[model samples]
Target: MRSNVLGSAADFRRGGHSSRRPLDSHLAQLFMRDLRADAPPQLPIFRSRLQGELLARLLLGPDREHTMLDLAVMLRTDLGSVVREVDRLARAGLLTLRRTAAGRLASRDTATPLHEPLAQLVMHTFGPKAVVAEEFGALPGAAEIHLFGAWAERYSGVAGEPPGDVEVLVVGAVDPGAAFDAAQESAARLGLPVHPVVRTVGEWRDDTDPFLRQIRACSLVRAR
Candidate 1:
């Protein structure tokens, strides 16, 4: 009887209790595959850089009101392009324009069921890798940079809440003052706190430290 119980346990561990697809709530491999198969494709949004970036910003801060000029300036794109893409997205029902007391504001349409899912997809794919690379690429003495914590987990498609902060691990003898200053500027732009943790290569390689071990266990996105 003990052997029989052990075998059943092993089956559950290796391939699940029967051959049927696991429940979605369980988050098993089969369940995740099924979820992906059932999900609507988001390839259209990614086809255009301007559209993709605009959607990302909208989803990132759904509550905030975005103007045509504001989005154009933030994305570093031309006004004409921003205006065209905004019209397209608005027509597609992904965004809505409101005549506010201050001016016109473009905001994500929360009423659509696609709002949450689309946001998750955009954030999972285009999270913070590009921004981090652009921010820290030219920093002196920074040999490598990695993104971990909530952002990394979301980027890897692990279901979680939107990241409230950006955490990066820099493996090199980088300047903390410079790192802090850069992080502050990045945080201001991103509307979230940017934290850069500096560590030597040797320190990073040493897995004996509890914090390092924990970092090693989670998903990481390499920026450099």
Candidate 2:
């Protein structure tokens, strides 16, 4: 029965809804495949970037229900993809889904055996953005926060080794001391070093500094 549900979920991904192929069948092979084992090590544990982002958002923080629209908008992906992935996860027992007046809601299934370990894995990899956002988002006078360096590069799809630490750039009137405290908290939460460098908005906009110029040349993932 479980296999049938999983197969039907796969069929949904294939633009069909009626097929009930076996779980191991070509069309019904694992919803989130281990295909990324050979891919460049950017969030390499997951089969696709969407998968990583979706799981990270749902698993890395407080367990709460989210509508499909919420996940799609947060991840900046299409609704169809989010719905499909949510359905796949729900069928796999990693997520639970139910209908409400607002729409279908999904949340991580804490009872699943994979929940704890998978959340831990996500916390170390795709978890940085969520952690940083939550920690630094409320900083008074802070205008912009972005993730840069190897982690940002990897998150932006630049192939490289997994990042050892997270580098953050804060641009605004934020106090350096407060930013440092936030970084420390984020690092503690993620089990990885988080370095947040503060710069005045004017300095960030200045094109004369070689360091700022270098940063502009690379990928920057907004934390807030």
Best by lDDT: 2
TM-score of each: 0.64, 0.48
What is the lDDT, from 0 to 100, of the residue 18 in candidate 2? 41
Alpha-carbon runs more than 4 Å astray in model 1: 1-48, 61-63, 76-81, 110-121
Quick one: how many clashes does candidate 1 have? Answer: 0
Residue 102 lDDT in candidate 2: 91
Model 2, residue 167: C-alpha shift (Å): 0.3
The per-residue C-alpha lDDT of model 1 at residue 33 equals 34
Top candidate on TM-score is: 1
- In model 2, the worst 10-residue window by lDDT is 31-40
TM-score (C-alpha, index-matched) for candidate 1: 0.64
Predicted candidate 1 versus true structure: per-residue lDDT over 1-224, tens digit per residue: 12332444477668775678654664455333322332223354253555666777777732677888888777776665677567667776888998877766888898988887887776654446666776877678888899999888877778766777899888888888888887876665455678999888889988898997898899988988
lDDT of 2 by residue, 102-143 (tens): 999998888989997787677556688777887899889889
